[model samples]
Target: MTVFEQRRQALKESLRVRGLPALLVSHAANRWYLSGFELADSQCNESAGWLVITAHGGDTLLTDPRFEEAARRVWSDEIVIYSSRKMEVVGAFLKSLNPPALGFEPRSLCVRDYERLREFVALTPTEGLVEDLRVIKDADEIRRMEASCVLNERVMLALPERLVPGMTEAQASWEVERLFREGGASGLAFPTIVGAGVNAALPHAEPGQDRLPAQGLVLVDAGGRLDAYCSDQTRTFWLGSEPSDRFRHVLALVREAQRRAIEYIRPGAPIAESYHLVRRFFEEHGVADRFTHGLGHGVGLETHEAPSLSSQSRDVFRPGMVVTVEPGLYWPDWGGVRWEHMVLVTEDGCRVL
Candidate 1:
């Protein structure tokens, strides 16, 4: 079955088990998953669009008149489009049905939207009912995500050749983005990180006007999206002479840790085990405290999603799951080194794409 059908079936089962009469998916990602209609373009258009799935297998696509044609073009026949000035129209429709319970995404909906929803109908906050349903990838979603990964890999392979010593970080970032678009990416999954020398120490550092160091480290962390799926990667390079022995040691350890983490991942393995394996590798290298971030996270329609692979996460690795294995070490005065690769969880082992 298609992803939309799988999602509908999952939510239908949840509603049945939870005794909810229907669910009102207000989050754009959930709505898109349920109805196959992407309303992101209409986020700022003052149109309160939503996807409603009834326990009785009824699916409706609620939107303002402006999106009537667009919604019709993309959604299935079961999708019932409605014209509305505000989301209250949907709440009013649901109230008229007098359903016993209306489900809302507690994690994605804001306090303001929650209050507004309360003004219209009774809402029961639900955590991860829909997001959990999205954790597993169907054949189609994985295909799209793999395509995104391929695009990202190609873009990164091309990026190193463009790095000139005099170019500012911002200029280098722009070049990478241009290459991404030219290589068939829909857009960037996240803000590109182009940090040179000490700036590379900041894991989430932003691209700036600082010039690239003549003989130091240059870290490029970037990703691109295709068909709403995303890929994230980080690669650090040397500009001139070989890096110092200290830098080389850190770089080698980081890469080895990332490799070991990927090798240790398997179906039914606790994610924490893989995290600790990488942590132990860092600790053995005497840079354990320098590693500040978790090992990795799920990559999908959203850059960071579910099934996080970290030291504290309790999720067990499962087949059909996509995650990144990124291990790094940073020093404020010096620089950081991280090597990240996306992988797919499998029955016997994991495969890096």
Candidate 2:
């Protein structure tokens, strides 16, 4: 069977096991994962298409006329065109199926749409039916992920040399975009975060007018999308020949924390342990509170997916899963350091991409 068929079959089996007659897939990535449709949703409020798959058998791709030809190319047998009011057409299609219950992802559907969709049928709000399958990467997916990571690293490593003193954060951000395209990436997985000096303290700080200093920290968090897969990475660079004693010590700790956490990544290892391990390491240094966000997240068709690595995550390591391992210490009004890399969970351990 084709990969798409295999994916749908797996999802169908899940539906049968859960006693769901049909599943309404509205998430853009989930739709692409099952149907091989590439056009992305322009916005969360606006959908490019939707997929209705039954438990026992049958499926249909519902899209507007603008994407009729594109949708038909991926799903030839059943393509329903709706010029406007997608939920209205979708309600009619579900009524025609006449299933006792219909499943949908609550995270994907807006509240108003959900209220509208339920008026026509019994709505079952399902979570992670498609996402659970996405966490594990197939062999082909691994290849694409590997290639994408290679592209991301190439751009990341090259940027330091090109960055000149007095370059604005926004200008540096543009350089990152250019490098990704130069490396033949389809696009960025997320907005390139270029923060220098005190700005680095804001983990998700948007690139701004802050200029690169001759002797301070420059933190870059970036990702590139390629072959339908995504790559995430981060690194902090020192502008001068040497960094301050405190900066060196902090960077060392973060690197060591990242290394130890990665070594602990393997099949059957609780996903949350990795984050706590780093937390403990930082706590020993009395900087645990400074280590703000989660350790990392799974990366694939989406930069962030399932099986997260954090104190709150309940996932476990599984072979064929790809995730990022980023650890850092940030101080407001001061420079920060974050080191990140993508790792593929394997039979024995993990491979840094």
Candidate 3:
């Protein structure tokens, strides 16, 4: 069977084991994962498309005319086109089958759709039916992700040459996006962050018109996507001839924390351990509170996915899982320092991408 068919079969088996008759999949990513169909949803309220899969391995795509042709080209046999009355069409199909129970992704379906769908058939909320499968990358998926990572590193390494002393943060951000496209990337995984000096204190700081500081630090967090797979990385650069003693120390600590966390990754290790390891390291250094946010998260078709690395996460490291290890320290007065690395979980340990 093809990869897409295999994925569909796996999901079907999960539904069968759970005693579910069918599933109504609304998440765009989950739809692409199962059917090889890719379409961007304009907003949370707008759906690019939806998939209805039966427990016995039957599959169908319900989409508007705007995406009908493309869906047909990708999944010809299973395409259903409807301009309006989306729920009416779906209800007609469900009524014909009249299965024991119907499952749906609660997180993806909006309230109106969910309430309307329930009026036709009993709806059972299911979580991570497809996402659990996504967390584990197959051989082919790993290859595509590696290609994205290589391109991201190349773009990052070449930035020093393009960043002039007086360049504005917004200008630098634009250059990063341009470089991603020129470097053979399909697009950026997320908005490029180009924070200089005090601006770096905000972890997700928006790139502004503020000019680069005469001296101090510039922190860049960026990534590129290739073939829908994503790569994420971050680094802090010293802009002056030399950094202050405190600045150097904070950078060293963050780097060490990131390095240790990455080295600790191994199959079966609890994901929360990675977060605590970094937290403990920072706590020992008396800056534990400064280490804000989770340690890292899984990366793939989406920049962030399952198997999060954080104090509250319950996931365990498993082979074929790709995740980022980013640890940072933020100080209002001193700005911030962050270092990130992408690693692929393997049987024994992980390979840094």
Candidate number achieving the greatest TM-score relative to the actual structure: 2
Residues 21-73, model 3: lDDT tens digits: 89988998889988888734778788878999998856889889888878887
Report every candidate's CA lDDT.
Answer: 0.83, 0.91, 0.88
Q: Evaluate model 2: give its TM-score.
A: 0.98
Q: 2 or 3: which has the higher lDDT?
A: 2
Report the error of model 2 at residue 130, Å. Answer: 0.2
Q: In candidate 2, which residue ranges exceed 4 Å CA deviation?
A: none
Measured on C-alpha atoms, candidate 2 has an lDDT of: 0.91
Query: What overall lDDT, based on C-alpha atoms, would model 3 receive against the true structure?
Result: 0.88
Which of candidates 2 and 3 reaches a greater TM-score?
2
Predicted structure 1, TM vs. truth: 0.94
After superposition, the stretches of candidate 1 with alpha carbons farther than 4 Å from their true spots are 39-48, 77-84
Write candidate 1's Cα lDDT for 1-353 as tens digits. 76687679889998899888788787777777777777254454343467778888567777777777878877765444455346566556767767766888776677876787777678897787777877888788889988999988888888768898989999999988998899888888889999999999999989999999788889999998888788999999888777788778888899889888998999989999988998888788778999999999988878888888877888898998999999989999998998999999977998998
Pairs in steric clash, model 2: none
> Estimated TM-score per prediction?
0.94, 0.98, 0.97
Which has the greatest lDDT?
A: 2
lDDT score, candidate 1, position 329:
90
Better of 1 and 2 by TM-score: 2
Best-to-worst order by TM-score is 2, 3, 1
Which 10 consecutive positions of candidate 2 have the poorest summed lDDT? 76-85
